[model samples]
Target chain A: MRPFLYERADQPEAAVIAARIQGQQQAPPTAAAAQFIAGGTTILDLMKLDVMQPQTLVNVGKLPGTIEMSDQGLRLGASVKMAEAAENEIVKRDFPVIAQALQLAASQQIRNMASLGGNVLQRTRCPYFRDVSYSACNKRNPGSGCSALDGHNRNLAILGTSDKCIASYPGDFAQALIALDAQVETLGPNGGRSLAFADLHKEPGDTPNIETQLQPGELISAFVVPTGAWTRRSLYLKIRDRESYEFALASAAIALDMDGQTVRGSRIALGGVATRPWRAREAEETINGQTLNDETARGAAEAAFRGAKVYSHNAFKVELGRRTLARALLDAGRMEI
Target chain B: MGFSMSQSEKPGGLNRRSFLTATAMGATLPVIQQARAQQAESAPADPRAPVDVKLRINGRDQSLRLDARTTLLDTLREHVGLTGSKKGCDQGQCGACTVLVDGTRVLSCLTLAVMAQGSEITTIEGLASSDGALHPMQQAFIDHDAFQCGYCTPGQIMSAVACVNEGHAGTNDDIREYMSGNLCRCAAYPNIVAAINQAKNEMRKA
Candidate 1:
């Protein structure tokens, strides 16, 4: 890893100022100038792989780390460690999907150090993108052809695939946030702004280089999840090669608002099968006002994977993802809460 | 001459004009300026220079001058001589470098030493009492024969201690789920879980 200047920010404004100072030196500003360091799990891993090179790092771990719960719902600070949020009593009670997503995402040690904000912004685990020796990853180097398109792409995305990139967004918590309609609060040079969690990640379009809508020097301060009828009846179902400490092959975060047996409303998000955190609104609409049973669950699952594109080795993901959603929906529907 | 004396005697000492006058008389002002320029050009870029970091490890404060990229794992093994925490996979995939920061288990391989500035770090070396008595978790590992190759013992023990403290070791499955981070290639998982359970029971009894 290359040596870089390190600055600790005592406040959110100071961190943004330091980032703005470094942002001026680089044109078409990206995260490479002065990246905010929180948890240091993803950034350090990329730095060691030579995939990311930042000239300066602004440490934002010292910023306020709070986990507030109220009638408005849970407000998780950006710096709150993943494990803390996963294990919080309020989070587990009100937002089981959020807690389960965090718990099942990474190893125990990683969850202990990784912050909520950092977890959502973690880069894809595409081998081509991670190993810099490959010169064809467009996400790593813009305009380069994606090697995964023709190479080992069994784990590549099936949805939101452009000709430019096929790397899957390897995160679980973001799916839960999208399913629950969480809002991301960010502080930047222009001041504070709130955006839907669904807008956090962008599809790998021709400009796969620009991943997020966040401007340079913007620091995510907190994630506010509003109270909802479906919050308590939500579950995150992950299927992977191993039982734990592995990225999902295909996962589903499902929440159902049931009036007796009929579904009043539903929220569904799929992970490990798409280029971005994927919300299946069409699937949700299919199951709305209908009773959740084997037939209905299967129909909704099929609707979820309606536009899925397949490769040689990843055709299994479409079926696996459908089953995952079906099982999660049925499981969540059966909950007595 | 009066002006020179007064300039030299100024409280601030060595005014730029006086220094230039002294160097001019010595007839090496141009050479000195050229040397200064060379030094400036040869100096490392500011961002690449090593930074001083202070870490509280094993109940002692140790200060180190390290590159900004130095990880806590490297700082402990290479600089502080605490080699008990192994670096199996430098990436966060494996938990061989697990240590306690403020009593919470974290991966030292991914943790920059500078980020641990104000936190209390407890490594495998600090597990035993100063009188040479083993910690309950350490003794449990021995009693249960939890390890064979022993490369992942330190991390497993640290995580087990934390798991028990966090009340995640209530059952066999809970131990397996929570302790999934530490992987033992020797496949000593059953014994490891037994050790953690024993340790948790002993601590509860105490």
Candidate 2:
């Protein structure tokens, strides 16, 4: 609850420019720094936990002309609420899986306030990391000992985890986007550029804080999903400890194109059990040229968790992940093309 | 910002309809003591700093700037003089603190007042008509008898409004799933479902 200055930008460029100016204005070793505010759900939550300390918050929610929808696909403003994006006619009709994922990801209230961009960028909800006094989260403080590596880590990562960090990417929407091969548009100091959605998240290797590939002073403007036959045949399956308002213990997003009864091409991504929105390339390859059946689906599912490594408390995730992926693929296969 | 509810607005002056309506809504709120009593005999010590907050409840932007640590639950009752929203767990586990931000329902205890600004917020107080007409949902709650102790009523009503708006009240199971976030200690879930069903039917009529 530290005091901080606030400014609402009228334009996206102005917000970016203001952020850059604020970053430059801060003298070395000074406390006066600015952070971009979008949705304010995750950032504020972290701030309350003393995980982030910024002197200024540049309000980017009111930035003009960021949301748009066209023949290209839905272009959601970075600040567009997750609930709105999930329920958008174009998204729900063209990509019901994405809609279902968002619907089941968070509670209705959180979905209402959380933005599409915010959902993609939400940090891990690791309890130890949020509680800074615990002194065991590499993501919160790099090079520090990871308490979760040995402690209660039932919700921690099972894939792409390192001895340094085992936190998972706790985003439901990102898995769907990765499955659809969405593109992310960002406006940085050097102007605008587009990146493959799947490439946005970096591996947890050493620096878990540097989670995404976006450069400093960069603002995500919109995310676009390209039109394809697979777009209409997508499904998101999340398995959590509870029925609602819970993060996935193991989730999968699947999009497939079928030729009669045979699988043509498919995109698969795993969530809650991986460090990133994991695209299951092995599973996709295994399912290709094969008909939709329990055996083939189970083989692809097995391929999805081929090299999954287990931690002290997360050994259950490997089996849960395999089953979740198998169920998602079979569900997608049942959809009418 | 200059608006405030009249200090003379007495909780006792509430009409029979209003009283029954509030009770109907309050009936949905959780009486935590009862819940704990039923759960078991085991007990454990709890340790957490209490944060104080002064929210601008309803139209009156009252400021009781508290311990930067008070929750919205303690803030409304202790500072802003509004007690419609109940505190079930003080944790985000229950949806008893559900209130509307602009038009969307949120767990107020989890939200800080400083974050809510320039948005036309509404609570159970603002959900009714100025002349004391009960909101359709309130009437529906009474008709459906959606509560037992009435502690969780306000939150249930608030979330019910949101559910209809979000189109999540389509079926009985849908209402049950969406309303799962709010827990009624009285185990009056059947009545709550009936209330939501009645409210959806009323909304459809409108």
Local distance difference test values of all predictions, in order: 0.86, 0.74
Indicate the residue-level lDDT of A150 in model 2.
79
- Which regions of candidate 2 deviate over 4 angstroms? A24-32, A64-72, B1-79, B87-93, B109-115, B142-145, B148-151, B203-206
C-alpha displacement of B178 in model 1, angstroms?
A: 0.6
Q: Write the per-residue lDDT of candidate 2 for residues B98-191, one digit (tens) a residue.
A: 8887778887776545455444567888788789988889998898788889998999999998898778998988888788778889988898
State every prediction's TM-score relative to the real structure: 0.91, 0.82
lDDT (Cα, tens digit) per residue for candidate 2, span A68-103: 567867676777887787778877888887888888
Candidate 1 structure quality by residue, lDDT tens digits, A225-333: 9888999999999999999999999999988899998999999999999999999998999999999899999999999999998876788999999999999999999
Error of 2 at A255 (Å): 0.5
User: What are the chain A TM-scores of the candidates, in order?
Assistant: 0.98, 0.95
